[model samples]
Target: MALLTYTPEIAEARDKGHPIVALESTIITHGMPWPQNRDMARQVEADIRAAGAIPATIAVMDGEILIGLSAGQLDRLAQTQDALKLSRADLAIALATGRTGATTVAATMICAQLAGIEVFATGGIGGVHRGAELSFDISADLQELAQTRVTVVAAGAKAILDLPKTLEVLETLGVPVIAYGQDALPAFWSRDSGLKAPLRMDAPAQIAASHRMRARLGLPGGQLVANPIPAADELPSAMLSPLIETALSEAAAQGISAKGVTPFLLRRIFELTDGASLAANIALVRNNARLAAEIARALA
Candidate 1:
Protein backbone atom coordinates (compact mmCIF):
# COMPACT_ATOMS: atom_id res chain seq x y z
CA MET A 1 0.00 0.00 0.00
CA ALA A 2 1.10 3.57 -0.69
CA LEU A 3 2.13 5.34 2.50
CA LEU A 4 1.87 8.86 1.03
CA THR A 5 -0.98 10.70 -0.62
CA TYR A 6 -1.03 14.03 -2.44
CA THR A 7 -3.65 16.68 -2.99
CA PRO A 8 -4.72 17.32 -6.57
CA GLU A 9 -2.77 20.58 -6.72
CA ILE A 10 0.43 19.01 -5.43
CA ALA A 11 0.03 16.01 -7.71
CA GLU A 12 -0.26 18.32 -10.69
CA ALA A 13 2.71 20.33 -9.55
CA ARG A 14 4.81 17.21 -9.17
CA ASP A 15 3.85 16.02 -12.63
CA LYS A 16 4.85 19.37 -14.12
CA GLY A 17 8.10 19.61 -12.12
CA HIS A 18 7.01 22.79 -10.40
CA PRO A 19 8.61 24.12 -7.27
CA ILE A 20 6.88 23.01 -4.08
CA VAL A 21 7.29 24.20 -0.49
CA ALA A 22 6.39 21.96 2.44
CA LEU A 23 4.42 23.48 5.34
CA GLU A 24 3.92 22.02 8.80
CA SER A 25 0.33 21.30 9.96
CA THR A 26 0.93 22.00 13.64
CA ILE A 27 0.64 25.72 12.95
CA ILE A 28 -2.92 25.07 11.84
CA THR A 29 -3.90 22.46 14.41
CA HIS A 30 -2.11 23.67 17.55
CA GLY A 31 -0.69 27.15 16.92
CA MET A 32 -3.87 29.17 16.77
CA PRO A 33 -7.65 29.19 17.29
CA TRP A 34 -9.96 27.54 14.76
CA PRO A 35 -11.12 30.12 12.23
CA GLN A 36 -7.93 32.12 12.54
CA ASN A 37 -5.83 29.01 12.11
CA ARG A 38 -7.71 28.08 8.95
CA ASP A 39 -7.48 31.66 7.69
CA MET A 40 -3.75 31.83 8.38
CA ALA A 41 -3.18 28.53 6.61
CA ARG A 42 -4.98 29.87 3.56
CA GLN A 43 -2.96 33.08 3.57
CA VAL A 44 0.35 31.25 3.88
CA GLU A 45 -0.57 28.91 1.03
CA ALA A 46 -1.55 31.92 -1.02
CA ASP A 47 1.74 33.56 -0.21
CA ILE A 48 3.59 30.54 -1.54
CA ARG A 49 1.50 30.59 -4.70
CA ALA A 50 2.14 34.28 -5.14
CA ALA A 51 5.85 33.54 -4.93
CA GLY A 52 5.43 30.96 -7.75
CA ALA A 53 5.56 27.72 -5.76
CA ILE A 54 3.01 25.13 -4.74
CA PRO A 55 2.40 24.69 -1.00
CA ALA A 56 2.31 21.17 0.40
CA THR A 57 0.92 21.32 3.94
CA ILE A 58 1.85 17.88 5.29
CA ALA A 59 -0.24 15.93 7.80
CA VAL A 60 -1.29 12.41 8.69
CA MET A 61 -4.94 11.38 8.30
CA ASP A 62 -6.75 8.07 7.98
CA GLY A 63 -3.54 6.05 8.19
CA GLU A 64 -1.70 7.84 5.39
CA ILE A 65 0.80 10.65 5.19
CA LEU A 66 -0.80 13.50 3.31
CA ILE A 67 1.78 15.35 1.22
CA GLY A 68 -0.55 18.27 0.68
CA LEU A 69 -3.94 19.28 1.98
CA SER A 70 -7.01 20.42 0.12
CA ALA A 71 -9.14 23.27 1.45
CA GLY A 72 -11.58 20.88 3.07
CA GLN A 73 -8.83 18.80 4.58
CA LEU A 74 -7.09 21.90 5.95
CA ASP A 75 -10.32 23.21 7.40
CA ARG A 76 -11.11 19.90 9.04
CA LEU A 77 -7.62 19.59 10.46
CA ALA A 78 -7.69 23.13 11.81
CA GLN A 79 -10.98 22.50 13.61
CA THR A 80 -9.92 19.16 15.08
CA GLN A 81 -9.68 19.62 18.83
CA ASP A 82 -7.66 16.54 19.71
CA ALA A 83 -5.32 16.06 16.79
CA LEU A 84 -2.11 14.24 17.74
CA LYS A 85 1.07 16.29 17.40
CA LEU A 86 3.32 13.88 15.54
CA SER A 87 7.10 14.09 15.50
CA ARG A 88 9.85 11.78 14.27
CA ALA A 89 9.43 9.35 17.17
CA ASP A 90 5.70 8.69 16.67
CA LEU A 91 4.81 9.72 13.12
CA ALA A 92 4.54 6.08 12.11
CA ILE A 93 2.27 5.32 15.07
CA ALA A 94 -0.17 8.00 13.97
CA LEU A 95 -0.19 6.49 10.49
CA ALA A 96 -0.59 2.93 11.69
CA THR A 97 -3.49 3.79 14.01
CA GLY A 98 -5.51 5.65 11.36
CA ARG A 99 -5.32 8.79 13.46
CA THR A 100 -5.64 12.43 12.57
CA GLY A 101 -2.46 14.28 13.42
CA ALA A 102 -0.56 17.47 12.76
CA THR A 103 3.10 17.40 11.80
CA THR A 104 5.68 19.19 13.87
CA VAL A 105 8.82 20.60 12.21
CA ALA A 106 10.54 17.23 12.48
CA ALA A 107 7.61 15.26 11.18
CA THR A 108 6.97 17.74 8.38
CA MET A 109 10.58 17.47 7.21
CA ILE A 110 10.31 13.71 7.23
CA CYS A 111 7.13 13.80 5.18
CA ALA A 112 8.59 16.35 2.78
CA GLN A 113 11.62 14.15 2.20
CA LEU A 114 9.38 11.19 1.61
CA ALA A 115 7.46 13.19 -1.01
CA GLY A 116 10.69 14.41 -2.68
CA ILE A 117 10.03 18.02 -1.67
CA GLU A 118 13.11 20.05 -0.74
CA VAL A 119 12.04 23.17 1.11
CA PHE A 120 9.89 23.83 4.22
CA ALA A 121 8.65 27.01 5.87
CA THR A 122 7.38 27.74 9.36
CA GLY A 123 7.15 30.52 11.94
CA GLY A 124 10.09 29.04 13.84
CA ILE A 125 11.77 25.72 14.58
CA GLY A 126 11.75 24.22 18.06
CA GLY A 127 14.96 24.01 20.04
CA VAL A 128 16.49 23.32 23.46
CA HIS A 129 14.01 24.25 26.15
CA ARG A 130 15.19 26.58 28.89
CA GLY A 131 15.83 23.84 31.43
CA ALA A 132 17.02 21.17 28.99
CA GLU A 133 20.21 20.71 30.98
CA LEU A 134 18.24 18.97 33.68
CA SER A 135 15.04 18.01 31.90
CA PHE A 136 16.92 17.03 28.73
CA ASP A 137 13.76 17.96 26.91
CA ILE A 138 15.25 19.16 23.64
CA SER A 139 12.88 19.21 20.73
CA ALA A 140 13.17 16.48 18.12
CA ASP A 141 13.16 19.21 15.46
CA LEU A 142 16.85 19.92 16.07
CA GLN A 143 17.86 16.30 15.60
CA GLU A 144 15.68 16.08 12.51
CA LEU A 145 17.54 18.99 10.96
CA ALA A 146 20.76 17.21 11.75
CA GLN A 147 19.65 14.32 9.52
CA THR A 148 16.84 15.47 7.20
CA ARG A 149 17.71 16.84 3.78
CA VAL A 150 14.99 19.46 3.41
CA THR A 151 16.08 23.07 3.70
CA VAL A 152 14.07 24.90 6.37
CA VAL A 153 13.21 28.59 6.25
CA ALA A 154 12.02 30.25 9.47
CA ALA A 155 12.43 33.36 11.55
CA GLY A 156 14.74 31.20 13.70
CA ALA A 157 14.41 28.92 16.69
CA LYS A 158 11.42 29.73 18.90
CA ALA A 159 12.46 32.64 21.13
CA ILE A 160 10.97 31.05 24.23
CA LEU A 161 13.71 28.40 24.04
CA ASP A 162 17.30 28.78 25.11
CA LEU A 163 18.72 30.29 21.89
CA PRO A 164 22.39 30.01 22.82
CA LYS A 165 22.03 26.39 23.77
CA THR A 166 20.05 25.69 20.62
CA LEU A 167 22.81 27.16 18.48
CA GLU A 168 25.41 25.11 20.34
CA VAL A 169 23.47 21.93 19.74
CA LEU A 170 23.01 22.70 16.05
CA GLU A 171 26.71 23.30 15.77
CA THR A 172 27.56 20.10 17.61
CA LEU A 173 25.30 18.16 15.28
CA GLY A 174 27.08 19.70 12.25
CA VAL A 175 23.98 21.47 11.03
CA PRO A 176 24.64 24.58 9.01
CA VAL A 177 22.78 27.57 10.46
CA ILE A 178 22.70 30.42 7.95
CA ALA A 179 21.22 33.81 8.72
CA TYR A 180 19.52 35.28 5.68
CA GLY A 181 20.88 38.75 4.83
CA GLN A 182 22.14 39.30 8.36
CA ASP A 183 25.00 38.47 10.68
CA ALA A 184 22.84 37.88 13.74
CA LEU A 185 20.41 34.99 14.10
CA PRO A 186 16.76 35.97 14.40
CA ALA A 187 14.82 35.20 17.57
CA PHE A 188 11.35 34.25 16.30
CA TRP A 189 9.27 37.42 16.91
CA SER A 190 12.43 39.48 17.19
CA ARG A 191 14.84 40.55 14.44
CA ASP A 192 18.09 39.99 16.32
CA SER A 193 19.06 37.18 18.67
CA GLY A 194 22.30 38.94 19.87
CA LEU A 195 24.39 36.01 18.67
CA LYS A 196 26.44 35.82 15.50
CA ALA A 197 25.31 33.38 12.82
CA PRO A 198 27.99 31.02 11.60
CA LEU A 199 26.99 31.65 8.01
CA ARG A 200 25.17 34.39 6.14
CA MET A 201 23.53 34.24 2.72
CA ASP A 202 22.16 37.24 0.87
CA ALA A 203 19.97 35.52 -1.70
CA PRO A 204 17.80 32.49 -2.22
CA ALA A 205 20.02 31.22 -5.01
CA GLN A 206 22.97 31.29 -2.66
CA ILE A 207 21.04 29.26 -0.15
CA ALA A 208 19.99 26.78 -2.79
CA ALA A 209 23.55 26.43 -4.03
CA SER A 210 24.81 25.78 -0.54
CA HIS A 211 22.14 23.18 -0.04
CA ARG A 212 23.11 21.39 -3.23
CA MET A 213 26.77 21.67 -2.38
CA ARG A 214 26.22 20.11 1.02
CA ALA A 215 24.59 17.10 -0.60
CA ARG A 216 27.48 16.85 -3.05
CA LEU A 217 29.89 16.86 -0.10
CA GLY A 218 27.94 14.01 1.45
CA LEU A 219 26.71 16.04 4.43
CA PRO A 220 23.94 14.32 6.36
CA GLY A 221 21.64 17.24 7.24
CA GLY A 222 19.82 20.16 5.72
CA GLN A 223 20.73 23.84 6.07
CA LEU A 224 18.66 26.17 8.22
CA VAL A 225 17.88 29.57 6.69
CA ALA A 226 17.20 31.91 9.57
CA ASN A 227 15.01 34.47 7.89
CA PRO A 228 14.25 37.45 10.12
CA ILE A 229 10.79 38.86 10.64
CA PRO A 230 10.30 42.29 9.13
CA ALA A 231 11.42 45.10 11.39
CA ALA A 232 7.97 46.64 11.48
CA ASP A 233 6.49 43.34 12.55
CA GLU A 234 9.05 42.40 15.19
CA LEU A 235 8.25 42.59 18.92
CA PRO A 236 11.73 43.80 19.85
CA SER A 237 13.86 41.37 21.84
CA ALA A 238 14.20 43.70 24.84
CA MET A 239 10.44 43.81 25.41
CA LEU A 240 9.92 40.11 24.68
CA SER A 241 12.67 38.86 27.02
CA PRO A 242 10.96 39.85 30.25
CA LEU A 243 7.60 38.57 29.08
CA ILE A 244 9.24 35.23 28.16
CA GLU A 245 10.75 34.94 31.61
CA THR A 246 7.36 35.54 33.19
CA ALA A 247 5.68 32.96 30.94
CA LEU A 248 8.34 30.38 31.73
CA SER A 249 7.92 31.05 35.43
CA GLU A 250 4.16 30.63 35.17
CA ALA A 251 4.51 27.34 33.24
CA ALA A 252 6.87 25.94 35.86
CA ALA A 253 4.54 27.03 38.65
CA GLN A 254 1.60 25.41 36.90
CA GLY A 255 3.56 22.16 36.46
CA ILE A 256 3.42 22.29 32.69
CA SER A 257 6.05 19.98 31.17
CA ALA A 258 7.06 18.34 27.89
CA LYS A 259 4.65 18.98 25.00
CA GLY A 260 2.51 21.26 27.17
CA VAL A 261 5.27 23.78 27.84
CA THR A 262 5.54 25.50 24.43
CA PRO A 263 1.85 26.08 23.86
CA PHE A 264 1.44 27.23 27.43
CA LEU A 265 4.24 29.74 27.12
CA LEU A 266 3.04 30.98 23.72
CA ARG A 267 -0.52 31.49 24.97
CA ARG A 268 0.70 33.28 28.06
CA ILE A 269 2.95 35.47 25.98
CA PHE A 270 0.07 36.24 23.64
CA GLU A 271 -1.96 37.35 26.62
CA LEU A 272 0.88 39.35 28.13
CA THR A 273 1.58 41.06 24.81
CA ASP A 274 -2.11 41.71 24.11
CA GLY A 275 -2.01 39.63 20.88
CA ALA A 276 1.11 41.14 19.40
CA SER A 277 2.88 37.80 19.63
CA LEU A 278 0.31 36.04 17.50
CA ALA A 279 0.39 38.87 14.99
CA ALA A 280 4.16 38.62 14.79
CA ASN A 281 3.92 34.87 14.43
CA ILE A 282 1.56 35.21 11.48
CA ALA A 283 3.79 37.79 9.84
CA LEU A 284 6.91 35.68 10.24
CA VAL A 285 5.20 32.58 8.88
CA ARG A 286 4.02 34.41 5.79
CA ASN A 287 7.48 35.85 5.36
CA ASN A 288 8.99 32.38 5.58
CA ALA A 289 6.52 30.99 3.05
CA ARG A 290 7.61 33.57 0.52
CA LEU A 291 11.30 32.86 1.07
CA ALA A 292 10.82 29.13 0.97
CA ALA A 293 9.06 29.52 -2.34
CA GLU A 294 12.05 31.35 -3.70
CA ILE A 295 14.41 28.65 -2.50
CA ALA A 296 12.22 25.95 -3.95
CA ARG A 297 12.26 27.72 -7.26
CA ALA A 298 16.01 27.97 -7.13
CA LEU A 299 16.35 24.29 -6.41
CA ALA A 300 14.04 23.40 -9.25
Candidate 2:
Protein backbone atom coordinates (compact mmCIF):
# COMPACT_ATOMS: atom_id res chain seq x y z
CA MET A 1 0.00 0.00 0.00
CA ALA A 2 3.05 2.25 -0.12
CA LEU A 3 2.74 2.90 3.55
CA LEU A 4 6.26 4.18 3.98
CA THR A 5 6.70 7.75 2.87
CA TYR A 6 9.95 9.68 3.03
CA THR A 7 10.81 13.33 2.71
CA PRO A 8 13.15 14.30 -0.07
CA GLU A 9 16.17 14.55 2.18
CA ILE A 10 15.69 11.12 3.72
CA ALA A 11 14.80 9.58 0.34
CA GLU A 12 17.99 11.01 -1.11
CA ALA A 13 20.03 9.75 1.81
CA ARG A 14 18.57 6.28 1.43
CA ASP A 15 19.21 6.26 -2.31
CA LYS A 16 22.83 7.17 -1.76
CA GLY A 17 23.32 4.76 1.18
CA HIS A 18 24.06 7.57 3.61
CA PRO A 19 23.76 7.33 7.37
CA ILE A 20 20.39 8.25 8.83
CA VAL A 21 19.37 8.45 12.49
CA ALA A 22 15.70 7.86 13.25
CA LEU A 23 14.10 10.16 15.80
CA GLU A 24 10.87 9.42 17.68
CA SER A 25 8.02 12.00 17.41
CA THR A 26 6.48 11.73 20.90
CA ILE A 27 9.21 14.12 21.96
CA ILE A 28 7.55 16.61 19.66
CA THR A 29 3.90 15.95 20.44
CA HIS A 30 4.02 14.88 24.09
CA GLY A 31 7.47 15.55 25.49
CA MET A 32 7.39 19.33 25.57
CA PRO A 33 5.23 22.41 25.09
CA TRP A 34 4.58 23.63 21.53
CA PRO A 35 7.17 26.17 20.47
CA GLN A 36 9.82 24.64 22.69
CA ASN A 37 9.07 21.15 21.38
CA ARG A 38 9.42 22.39 17.80
CA ASP A 39 12.63 24.15 18.69
CA MET A 40 14.11 21.09 20.38
CA ALA A 41 13.17 18.84 17.48
CA ARG A 42 14.81 21.24 15.03
CA GLN A 43 17.96 21.52 17.12
CA VAL A 44 18.27 17.76 17.47
CA GLU A 45 17.87 17.36 13.71
CA ALA A 46 20.48 20.02 13.18
CA ASP A 47 22.83 18.21 15.54
CA ILE A 48 22.44 15.05 13.51
CA ARG A 49 23.19 16.95 10.32
CA ALA A 50 26.17 18.62 11.91
CA ALA A 51 27.40 15.15 12.84
CA GLY A 52 27.15 14.06 9.18
CA ALA A 53 23.93 12.07 9.20
CA ILE A 54 20.38 12.67 8.08
CA PRO A 55 17.70 12.75 10.76
CA ALA A 56 14.49 10.84 10.13
CA THR A 57 11.87 11.97 12.64
CA ILE A 58 9.24 9.27 12.25
CA ALA A 59 5.46 9.43 12.78
CA VAL A 60 2.26 8.05 11.27
CA MET A 61 -0.09 10.44 9.48
CA ASP A 62 -2.68 10.19 6.72
CA GLY A 63 -2.47 6.41 6.43
CA GLU A 64 1.29 6.45 5.94
CA ILE A 65 4.33 5.93 8.12
CA LEU A 66 6.48 8.94 7.43
CA ILE A 67 10.17 8.09 7.61
CA GLY A 68 11.03 11.71 7.91
CA LEU A 69 9.21 14.92 8.68
CA SER A 70 9.64 18.08 6.67
CA ALA A 71 9.77 21.42 8.48
CA GLY A 72 6.06 22.06 8.11
CA GLN A 73 5.13 18.53 9.12
CA LEU A 74 7.36 18.82 12.16
CA ASP A 75 5.70 22.08 13.10
CA ARG A 76 2.26 20.50 12.76
CA LEU A 77 3.26 17.48 14.83
CA ALA A 78 4.75 19.63 17.55
CA GLN A 79 1.35 21.19 18.11
CA THR A 80 -0.77 18.04 17.77
CA GLN A 81 -2.50 17.75 21.12
CA ASP A 82 -4.56 14.67 20.32
CA ALA A 83 -1.91 12.55 18.65
CA LEU A 84 -1.62 9.02 19.92
CA LYS A 85 1.65 8.05 21.58
CA LEU A 86 2.15 4.89 19.58
CA SER A 87 4.09 1.80 20.52
CA ARG A 88 4.53 -1.61 18.89
CA ALA A 89 1.03 -2.68 19.84
CA ASP A 90 -0.93 0.26 18.40
CA LEU A 91 1.27 1.61 15.59
CA ALA A 92 -0.44 -0.32 12.82
CA ILE A 93 -3.90 0.51 14.15
CA ALA A 94 -3.03 4.20 14.09
CA LEU A 95 -1.87 3.90 10.50
CA ALA A 96 -4.90 1.82 9.53
CA THR A 97 -7.26 4.42 10.93
CA GLY A 98 -5.42 7.22 9.08
CA ARG A 99 -4.90 8.85 12.45
CA THR A 100 -1.94 11.07 13.08
CA GLY A 101 0.25 9.66 15.84
CA ALA A 102 3.60 10.31 17.44
CA THR A 103 6.06 7.46 17.67
CA THR A 104 7.52 6.32 20.97
CA VAL A 105 10.83 4.48 21.38
CA ALA A 106 9.37 1.09 20.48
CA ALA A 107 7.43 2.32 17.47
CA THR A 108 10.35 4.38 16.25
CA MET A 109 12.64 1.36 16.29
CA ILE A 110 10.08 -0.62 14.35
CA CYS A 111 9.65 2.10 11.72
CA ALA A 112 13.38 2.76 11.54
CA GLN A 113 14.18 -0.86 10.81
CA LEU A 114 11.44 -1.01 8.19
CA ALA A 115 13.02 2.00 6.49
CA GLY A 116 16.45 0.22 6.64
CA ILE A 117 17.73 2.80 9.06
CA GLU A 118 19.93 1.28 11.82
CA VAL A 119 20.12 3.88 14.55
CA PHE A 120 17.65 5.79 16.72
CA ALA A 121 18.15 8.46 19.36
CA THR A 122 15.85 9.46 22.18
CA GLY A 123 16.21 11.17 25.56
CA GLY A 124 15.64 7.88 27.35
CA ILE A 125 13.81 4.63 26.90
CA GLY A 126 10.82 3.47 28.93
CA GLY A 127 11.44 0.54 31.20
CA VAL A 128 10.14 -1.24 34.30
CA HIS A 129 8.35 1.49 36.15
CA ARG A 130 8.69 1.76 39.91
CA GLY A 131 6.43 -0.68 41.79
CA ALA A 132 5.91 -2.77 38.68
CA GLU A 133 5.46 -5.96 40.67
CA LEU A 134 1.94 -5.06 41.76
CA SER A 135 0.97 -3.01 38.74
CA PHE A 136 2.93 -4.85 36.02
CA ASP A 137 3.49 -1.46 34.50
CA ILE A 138 6.56 -2.29 32.45
CA SER A 139 7.02 -0.44 29.18
CA ALA A 140 6.96 -2.06 25.75
CA ASP A 141 10.20 -0.39 24.70
CA LEU A 142 12.32 -3.08 26.36
CA GLN A 143 10.55 -5.87 24.48
CA GLU A 144 10.86 -3.96 21.21
CA LEU A 145 14.61 -3.71 21.79
CA ALA A 146 14.80 -7.47 22.18
CA GLN A 147 13.20 -7.98 18.75
CA THR A 148 13.91 -4.96 16.55
CA ARG A 149 17.26 -4.68 14.81
CA VAL A 150 17.76 -0.95 15.23
CA THR A 151 20.40 0.18 17.71
CA VAL A 152 18.83 2.67 20.15
CA VAL A 153 21.00 5.31 21.75
CA ALA A 154 19.74 7.07 24.83
CA ALA A 155 20.90 8.26 28.22
CA GLY A 156 19.34 5.13 29.71
CA ALA A 157 15.97 4.10 30.99
CA LYS A 158 14.19 7.16 32.35
CA ALA A 159 15.30 7.88 35.92
CA ILE A 160 11.71 7.67 37.03
CA LEU A 161 11.75 3.95 36.28
CA ASP A 162 13.15 1.17 38.40
CA LEU A 163 16.60 1.24 36.82
CA PRO A 164 17.89 -1.96 38.41
CA LYS A 165 14.83 -3.94 37.39
CA THR A 166 14.99 -2.42 33.92
CA LEU A 167 18.57 -3.58 33.54
CA GLU A 168 17.68 -7.00 34.85
CA VAL A 169 14.81 -7.35 32.41
CA LEU A 170 16.95 -6.22 29.51
CA GLU A 171 19.50 -8.82 30.48
CA THR A 172 16.82 -11.51 30.75
CA LEU A 173 15.59 -10.56 27.29
CA GLY A 174 19.14 -10.81 25.87
CA VAL A 175 19.34 -7.12 25.00
CA PRO A 176 22.90 -5.90 25.26
CA VAL A 177 23.08 -2.71 27.31
CA ILE A 178 26.35 -0.98 26.59
CA ALA A 179 27.50 2.11 28.39
CA TYR A 180 29.25 4.57 26.10
CA GLY A 181 32.69 5.59 27.33
CA GLN A 182 31.86 4.77 30.93
CA ASP A 183 31.45 1.91 33.32
CA ALA A 184 28.36 3.22 35.07
CA LEU A 185 24.98 3.30 33.39
CA PRO A 186 23.53 6.76 32.88
CA ALA A 187 20.14 7.79 34.17
CA PHE A 188 18.25 10.18 31.93
CA TRP A 189 18.97 13.82 32.94
CA SER A 190 21.91 12.55 34.98
CA ARG A 191 25.37 11.41 33.97
CA ASP A 192 25.40 8.32 36.20
CA SER A 193 22.89 5.87 37.56
CA GLY A 194 25.48 4.44 40.01
CA LEU A 195 24.83 1.02 38.57
CA LYS A 196 27.73 -0.60 36.77
CA ALA A 197 26.96 -1.26 33.11
CA PRO A 198 26.85 -4.80 31.80
CA LEU A 199 29.06 -3.76 28.90
CA ARG A 200 31.02 -0.74 27.79
CA MET A 201 32.31 0.58 24.46
CA ASP A 202 34.60 3.55 24.11
CA ALA A 203 33.88 4.41 20.49
CA PRO A 204 31.04 4.42 18.00
CA ALA A 205 33.02 2.18 15.67
CA GLN A 206 33.24 -0.42 18.37
CA ILE A 207 29.48 -0.26 18.88
CA ALA A 208 28.88 -0.46 15.12
CA ALA A 209 31.19 -3.44 14.85
CA SER A 210 29.30 -5.19 17.64
CA HIS A 211 26.06 -4.50 15.81
CA ARG A 212 27.49 -6.15 12.70
CA MET A 213 28.76 -9.08 14.72
CA ARG A 214 25.31 -9.63 16.15
CA ALA A 215 23.90 -9.79 12.60
CA ARG A 216 26.58 -12.21 11.60
CA LEU A 217 25.61 -14.43 14.52
CA GLY A 218 21.95 -14.25 13.45
CA LEU A 219 20.99 -12.34 16.59
CA PRO A 220 17.37 -11.24 16.69
CA GLY A 221 17.58 -7.92 18.51
CA GLY A 222 19.45 -4.59 18.69
CA GLN A 223 21.89 -2.93 21.08
CA LEU A 224 21.09 -0.32 23.72
CA VAL A 225 23.76 2.37 23.94
CA ALA A 226 23.61 4.16 27.27
CA ASN A 227 25.15 7.42 26.28
CA PRO A 228 25.63 9.67 29.29
CA ILE A 229 24.40 13.23 29.30
CA PRO A 230 27.19 15.76 29.21
CA ALA A 231 28.56 16.60 32.65
CA ALA A 232 27.70 20.27 32.40
CA ASP A 233 24.06 19.45 31.71
CA GLU A 234 23.35 16.66 34.20
CA LEU A 235 20.98 16.99 37.15
CA PRO A 236 22.79 15.14 39.89
CA SER A 237 21.04 11.97 40.95
CA ALA A 238 21.35 12.96 44.60
CA MET A 239 19.52 16.19 43.98
CA LEU A 240 16.81 14.38 42.02
CA SER A 241 16.10 11.25 44.09
CA PRO A 242 13.98 12.86 46.78
CA LEU A 243 12.04 14.86 44.26
CA ILE A 244 11.36 11.70 42.27
CA GLU A 245 10.09 9.96 45.38
CA THR A 246 7.74 12.81 46.04
CA ALA A 247 6.44 12.73 42.47
CA LEU A 248 5.89 8.99 42.66
CA SER A 249 4.00 9.33 45.91
CA GLU A 250 1.80 11.97 44.38
CA ALA A 251 1.10 9.84 41.33
CA ALA A 252 0.13 6.93 43.53
CA ALA A 253 -2.17 9.08 45.58
CA GLN A 254 -3.75 10.68 42.50
CA GLY A 255 -4.30 7.27 40.81
CA ILE A 256 -2.21 8.04 37.72
CA SER A 257 -1.32 4.81 35.97
CA ALA A 258 -0.74 3.01 32.68
CA LYS A 259 0.33 5.23 29.75
CA GLY A 260 -0.37 8.30 31.84
CA VAL A 261 2.21 7.56 34.52
CA THR A 262 5.45 8.64 32.89
CA PRO A 263 4.22 11.96 31.58
CA PHE A 264 2.50 12.80 34.82
CA LEU A 265 5.61 12.05 36.83
CA LEU A 266 7.75 14.04 34.44
CA ARG A 267 5.40 17.00 34.72
CA ARG A 268 5.39 16.85 38.51
CA ILE A 269 9.16 16.55 38.62
CA PHE A 270 9.41 19.47 36.23
CA GLU A 271 7.42 21.48 38.71
CA LEU A 272 9.44 20.18 41.67
CA THR A 273 12.67 21.10 39.99
CA ASP A 274 11.39 24.53 39.00
CA GLY A 275 11.94 23.99 35.24
CA ALA A 276 15.45 22.56 35.59
CA SER A 277 14.30 19.06 34.69
CA LEU A 278 13.12 20.16 31.25
CA ALA A 279 16.31 22.04 30.52
CA ALA A 280 18.30 18.95 31.40
CA ASN A 281 15.99 16.86 29.23
CA ILE A 282 16.69 19.07 26.21
CA ALA A 283 20.43 18.80 26.77
CA LEU A 284 20.46 15.01 27.08
CA VAL A 285 18.35 14.60 23.95
CA ARG A 286 20.79 16.71 21.97
CA ASN A 287 23.67 14.71 23.39
CA ASN A 288 22.00 11.44 22.43
CA ALA A 289 21.23 12.73 18.91
CA ARG A 290 24.87 13.60 18.33
CA LEU A 291 26.00 10.15 19.47
CA ALA A 292 23.33 8.38 17.42
CA ALA A 293 24.50 10.22 14.31
CA GLU A 294 28.04 9.06 14.99
CA ILE A 295 26.92 5.47 15.43
CA ALA A 296 24.86 5.70 12.24
CA ARG A 297 27.88 7.00 10.35
CA ALA A 298 30.03 4.20 11.69
CA LEU A 299 27.47 1.62 10.64
CA ALA A 300 27.11 3.21 7.20
Clashing pairs in 1: none
Candidate 2: give the clashing pairs: none
Off by over 4 Å in 2: none
lDDT agreement of model 2 with the native: 0.94
Native RMSD of candidate 1 (Å):
0.7
Q: Tell me the tens digit of each residue's lDDT in model 1 across 1-300.
A: 898999888999999999999999998888888798999999999999999999999999887899988888888899999999999989999888899999999999999998999999999999999999999989999999999999999999999999999999999999999999999999999999999999999999999999999899988889899999999999998999999999999999999999888888888999999999999999999999999999999999
**Candidate 1 Cα misplacement greater than 4 A, ranges:** none
Supply candidate 1's per-residue lDDT for 242. Answer: 95
Error of 2 at 283 (Å): 0.7
Per-residue lDDT tens digits of candidate 2, residues 84-140? 989989998998889999999999999999999999999999999999999999999
